[model samples]
Structure formats: C-alpha cells, structure tokens
Target: MASAPPAGQGQQGAAAAASPLAPSEMYRNYNFLLRLDSTEVRFTECLGLGMRIEPIRYRESGVGNVVRALPGPVAYAEVVLRYGLATTPDLWNWLKRTAEGAVVRRNVTISQLDNDGATPRINWNLYGAWPCQWSGVPFDALGREAAIEELRLAFDRLDRA
Candidate 1:
C-alpha cells in the first residue's frame, strides 16, 4: 500500500490550480491608443471612461417610513484627454472653431493595447463628442515639465465595441 502525502501538500496542489490569472495576462495600463474620426490626433492620456447609474426613489403611502429605490437611467460622464503640446495646429484649430459658435461632433475611439502593445484588446467608442473645455498646463519659470494640453468632451453616448 502507498502512504498519503503530507498534510499541506494536497491543499497546495489544489490551491495552485485554482489560483487567479496573473496581472501579466491582462493588457498593460500604459499601453493604450486614442483616435478621432475627424482628425488623426494622438493623445498621451485618456480619462473619465466611466458611467454611473442614477437611482430613483419612491415612497408609498401604505408602506412604513422606508423608501424604495430603483435603478434609473445610466448617465455617462465626460472624457478628458491630455497630450503634449505640438506644433501642428489642427486640434487647436478645431477647438477654436467650435468655441466661436460652431458646434462640431466627432466619433472617438480609445483602445486598450494587448500584451504585445500592438493588438487592440478592447475599444471604447464615443459618439457625437464635442469639446466643451480646454486647458493648458501651468507654467513655472524655474520648473521644467512637459507642456500638456487638456480637452474635455461631452459625448452623447458611450458604447463598448
């Protein structure tokens, strides 16, 4: 007859098999891409790719002091993109035109790169996005930093594709 293994060896074997996938399996946070339908503009950072569901509450006369809540519509938040200030002025021109009483909407796509940093793992598509705000990085005479430009967009909808 064969003897059983040690007390913890069997448990370790099972636990190893059930372990979660490592962070290496997912795409890196720094590897991402941003594209605009109107112009071929590259951005260094993308933020605010999230949505929240507002809750609607109601109270019934027959019920006690407690109120019932239900999930309401989903409200998409604005997306802000940051990029190093460049010489080419297409993006700035577009924003300027929009600020001068002309409204321009463009489709935007933000993709997460795969492990290889080339393939696209997932894409967030924004429809009918218009730039609502623009900001330039603060300047300091003594400090050295990259000149970053920020653009805030208000999109009609956001869909995962």
Candidate 2:
C-alpha cells in the first residue's frame, strides 16, 4: 500500500547512518585546532577572524542630494588567541623578536574539527601574519584560576576554505 523510496535513497540513508558525522551535522566551535605554519598549537579561544572594506563617499557634480558609497581599501582584523600558561616559548619568542625590530611573517590556519577531532570541517587561512601584541599571564597566589596568556596577530589577508 506504500510507495517505495526513490532510487539511491536507501543507500544514502545507510551511508549517513554509518558515518559518525553527517553532512547536516553542525560543527562545534569548541572543537578546533590552530596551526602556525607547520606547527600545531592548542588554544582555549580564538577571536576576531574578520575583515572589512572602508567605503568612500562621493557625490556627483550634478547630484545635490545623493551620495554614493564606493568601495575603498580592505582591512583585516587582528586575531586574538588565548591559552592557559605553559612552558612553550615559541609564541613568546616570536613576539619578542618582533618587538626587537625583527619581523617574521607566517601563515596561520584555524580549522574547525568534526566530532572525531581528527577531521577538519572548516578552515580559515591567515596569510603573512605576524605577532602584534602579547599579554602576559596574571599572577595571583590567592587566585584559584589557571594562568592564561593572550596573543594578538595581524595578518595581511584572510581566506575561508
């Protein structure tokens, strides 16, 4: 009395059921990894992955009441990465070299992983990135919170892949 499913529908359903993460499943933001060049670094938070275009307002000679906005230069936002304090000196060394007048740029990739943690669902690539600022972890003997360090990076371009 019931009509059969369309061709390949059963197979598709079986495949989806077998896979741990289906295409319709939304990726969790907390499951992500950061890579600077070839090295993988762990972080608690990543923010400010964005860009904006500055608009130039222009008025035609004959137009008196209308102002047109023209697209101008593009600006990429600085990305801030935070992690619990550790003995890793790579981040500190990079910031120190930059502050001492040596500029070293590297590509950074932030990938959103699936539930499996090994598969990357989304990737954001930052090109020609260099450390712009670093915040040292606050020390308090009475405090019961973990020490956290913050680093800000300035990049020339950002691409989502």
Q: TM-score of every model?
A: 0.82, 0.82
Candidate 2: where are CA atoms >4 Å away? 1-24
Residue 125 accuracy (lDDT) in model 1: 91
Q: Tell me the whole-model lDDT of each prediction, alpha carbons only.
A: 0.85, 0.92
> Pick by lDDT: which candidate is best?
2
Clash number for candidate 1? 0
Q: Estimate candidate 1's alpha-carbon lDDT, on a 0 to 1 scale.
A: 0.85
lDDT score of residue 49 within candidate 2 = 91
Candidate 2 lDDT by residue in tens digits, 9-89 = 786776776799777596777999999999999999999999999999999889979999999999999999999988978
Instruction: Give candidates' CA RMSD values in order.
Output: 4.6, 6.1
